[model samples]
Target: MGGAPERADGCGARVRGRSAGSGRLSVTARTRGWRDRAAAELAAAALATREETVGDVLVVGDRTGVLARALGDRGAAVHRWGRRLGEGEVVSAWPPDGTVVLSAVRLPRSRAELAFAVHAAAARTRPGGTIAVYGANDEGIRSADRALAAVAENVTTLRVGGHCRVVAGRRSEAHADGGPDVFAIDFELSADDWGSQRLRGCGGRYRTWPGVFGGAGLDAGTRALVRVMAGFDRSPERVLDFGCGWGPLARAARALWPDARVEALDVDALAVRAVAANAPGVEARLGDRVEGAACYDLIVANPPYHDGKEEDTRVIEALFSDGAGALREGGCMVLVVQRRLPVPRLAAARFRRARPLADEGIYRVWELVGPL
Candidate 1:
């Protein structure tokens, strides 16, 4: 009663009262059907609890749409990044510099990703505007305060609940010019590592944005897949690199079959952009499924097994199903997966003929012919 007032709505939700002077909702109560276990819910609650009023808010990496909806309901002008926005909503790669008053980030898994998100948010936020970074404590939210300090000042914890916490700070004018290029990394795959002198000749230099898989370096699994591809006796006319992270596979495919029309498809926007930047002329598409069934003469993939922090095979399995549908008659699909995964079993269930192409100890490459 001494602090901001509280009230219960007709629906039995205990909504936190707004400050009379600020006109900002102090906190949002958990509504029926809202899950406390979700990090998104905790982030929304934390934003509501902040003392500052939310105005012209930008929510980043909100895959679930929870934060955007909550802030909008509280009368904040909400813009979004990371996922597709609703129809009639403003959609851009990022908001214009110094236009946003507040930014809420759903902390990414990797530190490099965290740095990129924070820097971008700081760039978009007006001087002295707020940036709130939130995530589950188990997912490294504790280090968020330090991450924010790179581009912000007066950093402090805003709220803690549901095994999650939100840390916020005021964006510093000194770091307002930060952009994606601040975290972009350039590296090259050595000829020996790729096992192809031709691919090396095609230019090994590649660039990757933070948070893209295999951005730090080309992973061993992908390298193994590339070596196996180099051994193929026949050339493919139309190749699709499914789940092409940073377009390494697409790049290799292009080099091996110079005349082939190579395309890269990934679900991540950053990954798509990376493909465009790193592998010029390779068609990069952003989506989960392959378009135009039976159009591809070859489909190559090192499918993702993990969904966030958890190891989920369903992602690769779905890719297998989609790739199979996209392959033409006599076309082949090649995949590289960790040895611990049951790729043989999974591939057998989806393809008429699945055989081991290579066994590189920790990683295995499989070549499947005839889509069943």
Candidate 2:
């Protein structure tokens, strides 16, 4: 659920972690923006008073990437941890003395990760040194504060914008005496699809995993996109469904273009897995990769416009850029998106021409120039 926000710096490139099953998530602007702001605030606070300068710092949680990026920008040594080591790999590979570790998202799903972050912080920071943990109110900031309180009696919370906060505390051996033991919570999920479709969800079958959009069922925008699937030209030989969540578009597109090679690509691994389960014949891939370079005849997508916490058009934009690159000289691309999202402008710039197929205030289908 936690990672970097999209291009506040206009880099256009997005960083993605593993899927929920992997104990990580894609770093979109929604999560990253908050973490970046929080890390900046904490770094400023620590540097504000010259007397508080400790030898090293550590940041724990999913936002470790953001903290690492921010601290590196500020010339501070940084280390990060999460349920999986890859999440912290970028920062961990390059160790810094004034280390900053982020433990903001859910505590590590594994004890090894949790222990690594805690012990690394304690070992790096000198006595009377500062250790800060940041969390969004919705995530687990309150609980993390309680955990930090056990390690550092004087825990102070700094209000960061976007209903997020940065918590600063000092860790010492004494605080470890009565510190809380981290444990995982297990429960069953039961949901009845009260609106529209009736796909009752239970255990692993239900979507609802953290950070997956419309994990419950078809979202309104996605449903709208599905409504227009019947009209798309599916005659191309090699077809790609970008951001193909749960395989609805891929299945329908394949059915319409029976002879076409239909492959679904989604940054969210769960979506890829769902597509595989629901439409076994269709090919599914996790993360953004342009396979068969410049080989696709057509690319279609109902590109995602929102992350869990905010609106990020970057994903959609990147999809178009990558999709266009993969298409043959005369290939075509079709994108369905909300009318207000600025996708049309992006498409116009990237493609030879972008023409509207349908418009319904909230959603519009755009046809871009490709081959035929």
Candidate 3:
């Protein structure tokens, strides 16, 4: 919308920390276009003046994350929520109310994600403070508006410069229609039946949550990883499920090697929570990369290549190097990824030997050994 909002001349990338690959650096991309449009449209609104937005503008669920800097440039003390790629600070909890909360939707999200953002925004906004939501017309704005009516008073809509609509409402009640509470985070999930398959666990269903990768169901590549992994022998002393969404691989490792230490790591808080809550004995941690001196005998992952809607290989690129560092000498790493990725080249840089172990349609699994 609005000719794809112009990129800020000084806008650039920022690295939050790092991910799995030992040699790779995972940096957040500077996403422009629709994000800038939403920000610009908000600024142009009568109520979104410097006096209203400055020193207290809070943007949530915005993946592009361009608004924070844009507001900062305008002298507003800005606070942002949600993950930008894999980079973000651990916000112990939601900021208090009495501040303007601007929740904009980016990157297609499940209904659970949208509901959480909306209710979270409402709960964090003081009664009488503003809560503005922006979204593309086709991005379920109408459904959101219907839901917003429950928490806000005198709701109204305005068409913005982009093919977007800004729905402004004042926070009155924290609960929306008494339908669900504000902090309804789906911490425990039963993987949905996508197509014909289910990522079932020995206890029946694997646990997952909203906002986690493959939370809804297993993707094609993960399916391949599970299929290939099932065939491997179960004797590893310790295993790390790198970038584990909800500990599928970690669960698998645990099931196969009942005594092995199965650890799962992910950047998403939701995923971390699910793994901790429903994954039972599996160890779970946050952030994109690994820490600690414990070396893994085997590392399994279905690494993410996209940051939000944009294709970002930096994490994957970094994983090759970082993952190698997490393993002990003679240890091995098993991974599944899209065939187009230069896995062999990246793997060769870290592993002593890297080769494809299986192929399923567009996905490939590689078996790589830690250097001697």
Q: Could you give candidate 3's per-residue lDDT for residues 1-372 as a string of tens digits?
A: 001111121111122432213443333333334543564455345343535565456666444445555666667655555532322222222333444544333323556666565666665565766666666665655456666666677777754555566666677754543322233344333434222123344444455545667764567777678767667754778888878886667766666677988888765656766677556798776555554332777888898887445666777766666677767766788999888988878777777888898888999998888653
- In order, candidate lDDTs are 0.71, 0.52, 0.59
Residue range 1-372, candidate 2, lDDT tens digits: 123322211111123443123433443312345544554455444433433322233454443344455555565444443322234432221123342333222243233333334544544455556666554556555555665554454778744555456666666646332111122111233333212122122113432223333444655565555556555544688778877765656766665667778888665544655666655577766445343446777777877666435677766666666567678767888777888777557776567788877775677777788422
TM-score per model over all chains: 0.84, 0.55, 0.73
Name the best candidate (by TM-score): 1
Evaluation by TM-score, superior candidate among 1 and 3 = 1
Clashing pairs for predicted structure model 1, backbone only: 26-48
What's model 3's lDDT at 305?
80
Question: Which one wins on lDDT?
Answer: 1
Candidate 1 vs candidate 2: which has greater TM-score? 1
Clashes counted in candidate 2 amount to: 19
Error of 3 at 238 (Å): 2.3
Worst 10 residues of 1 by lDDT: 25-34
lDDT of 1 at 253: 88
Q: After superposition, how far is residue 334 of candidate 3 from its true place, in Å?
A: 0.9
